[model samples]
Target: MGITKTLNDDLIANRSEVSIAEFEASRRLGAREGVGGAASWAVWGNENDDLTIFEDSAAISPRLRKDVVLIGANFGLGGDTGEFPPFKNFHARKSGGDSKLRKAITGTALEGAFLTDIVKDYPTKDAKGLPTEIKSGTLDTNRYVLSGFKTEQEALGLSRDTLYIPMGDTTRILWDLLVDRGVIPAEQRVFHRAYGNGPLFKERPVTYLRHYAGAVDMVQAVQGLLAQLNLR
Candidate 1:
């Protein structure tokens, strides 16, 4: 009924290894030079103050590790607080709408030539009108999409030209298998942070695992979709 229930059920029933393999492969590709552009941005400090693009090798060298990775959750990183602090409150009512803030963030990332991806989970229906099935691992029946510009100058097209990947249940299972195999760390799990104070903002690390998997799936999906749409 709810997203968590759906994902959990999928994880329990999923039985595939291919998805995880694909996810790892994509991660390798994303990390490769000349495949995807790289840029630096600040990980917001407390209250979003002291913004600084992470440029120092010392600050970013850890990301070069084989196990180090980045997973972009659907919502912004900071979980909601009842009151918006000054720097982090750029999305507050006084500021522009969330959409504006999102665009600004994306724009900044794009300017730095960073690749961005989006992943979403939605229900699947069979001809009989019943929920068809749940997927596991990195790939899920849920849709995983990827989009980004070929170059920083092309960034403007990102808003319109997203590629899609149609992943099935087996894909998700493979992701879980990879996790079990120690290919990806559990801490890299991705989850959406709430925008405002909500019960869901308590910050459970496990819940974000699905989101991390979703990010991997998105990268692969985008590559496939681009080939299919002849946009590559």
Candidate 2:
């Protein structure tokens, strides 16, 4: 099928490619090699706090697909070297952050994995003043950045012809944008509504997770959703 007939113009004016290396790397990671479900799978988040979701998703299924893209919010201008989120700033205490979690997640397919951020070429900057995000046929990360869900869908090379699964609030932001454009149903836009379908997710609400083990439950939720979504 072509673009979705179910919706109108949802993409931005452009869809340019930013960092070729980053794009290729992320595409490789998002591949579903020897798998049975999606051709690829990627995850985007609000900030570093959401890495736990990625970690947990991988923990539950160690042999999980690598076609995973962790999209996080990247603020500020671009330089030659690609940019990553200032993850430390997001931590609550900042001084004595989650050490064990860091050890478990980093270099293990979770922490600091790079993808195109919503801030466009900020993740793969070579010069100072260049277009990043989305435009024409160019594509950057925009799940919640400039063009929001439209750019995100474009980055995925998808339209309403395909389906979307928003795992957490970060992705929910994009879903809400689709709703704004009359793409998604309004009822699914509930902010505080339940998210994942895992046992731990059902045991504790997303809100309650913050009060306790934090990223622990968040990881469970993403794993549940990914397991469910991959089947499609």
Candidate 3:
């Protein structure tokens, strides 16, 4: 079925996750320390480009594993053409790819999965400026961003077994960089972006999809991803 607004609404209603209001309150408190600070990153919300890292309201036992982690490239907060600009929390306005992503994960193992971006506060319309940001030293992937990512992972209680789904090539590249830097183990960079059966891809811990804003059959793509991750 094609993604619909009602699907997004129903999905939002059904999930017992942290609310935007509560998260915004947390963000406000964190912002006093600094935007994108270690504490803010650890919170289940976006620090800069309003993304939602929905944590279930019910307290999770420390021993229980969070099965999935969905990673995006960065917050695309710039551009006048944005359909749903962030309000208080970056993901407060769920339109375009945000809504598409939420809808696609419905009924799948990824439902209620923790969502975040590798690069925080680097707001652009897309990944076009990522290379520039990194090369110019304005964005520190290792010392800054990676640390925040680790903090978030630790806060979420994510383990190596957590199935990571980086949203696009940009995210995939960053994910690989993290793997190389020893932030993430090399073995965890399991599947190629194309995702096919081959000796090179005979492992687990990571899989990916096209960016939600790009041309993609969201439903079919996620269904295929579920099979790839054995979440079927």
Candidate 4:
């Protein structure tokens, strides 16, 4: 139940508490809530795209209880204020990005599955800007980001059988990069072999779909994809 088990050692070592006024100041600038799931663990960012994890309370170690994982592009906004303020869980909104994602997973195997984003803290209105922002960071920092990602995955208890659902092309691209960098762990490289799962993801255990942040019928689209992969 200690943060030492859920976060990277370096992050835990650097974490601290902020004043009430400082926390409110960040929220006014559009800082939102934490990641969704049993434990409210969130990886948030700032205007600069520096990422960090925030958790309200410690839960069991490696809380990934399912074989399916939902991967997103990045946390929308909010900088690292070192404050664990309460906010809506990931994809909990009824419209726009959150609604689209919420509808897609409803009544499917993906519902309540473990969800996360590739880029942690950098917030951008359009994910298209992600590439430039990601490239803006130093090589060592980016590599550290991947190392942190690997740390989170291991902390969450993800293994080879885990099927990652990339929310869109952007997410897929980032996830692929992580894999190439060996951030996804070599043993967990099994791809979905179902016939209709598409040759695009033929080499990875990823089911592709358009980003819910756009104007797409994510529910039907994702359901169809999941059905094709025998996850319905």
Q: Pick by lDDT: which candidate is best?
A: 3
Worst lDDT 10-window in candidate 3 = 33-42
Q: For residues 70-100, could you state the per-residue lDDT of candidate 2 as single tens digits?
A: 3322322334212222222123233222332
Report the error of model 4 at residue 42, Å.
Answer: 13
How well is each residue in 1-232 modelled by candidate 3, as lDDT tens digits? 9533322243234333434443444333323211242122212223223444324323322212244456676655542312332222224354566556656765654564555566654456667567566657667666446665555555454556555667777878877765765656665523353344412112432256667778776776665555552221
- What root-mean-square deviation over C-alphas does model 2 reach? 14.2
TM-score of each model, in listed order: 0.21, 0.31, 0.60, 0.57
Cα lDDT tens digits for candidate 1, 20-88: 332234333333322231221213322323323232434432222111112231212233321222123
Per-candidate total of colliding backbone pairs: 13, 18, 2, 3
Over the full model, what C-alpha lDDT does candidate 1 score relative to the true structure?
0.26
Poorest stretch of ten by lDDT in candidate 2: 5-14
Q: Which model scores highest in TM-score?
A: 3
Name the lDDT of candidate 3. Answer: 0.49
Error of 2 at 215 (Å): 3.2
**Which is superior by TM-score, 1 or 2?**
2
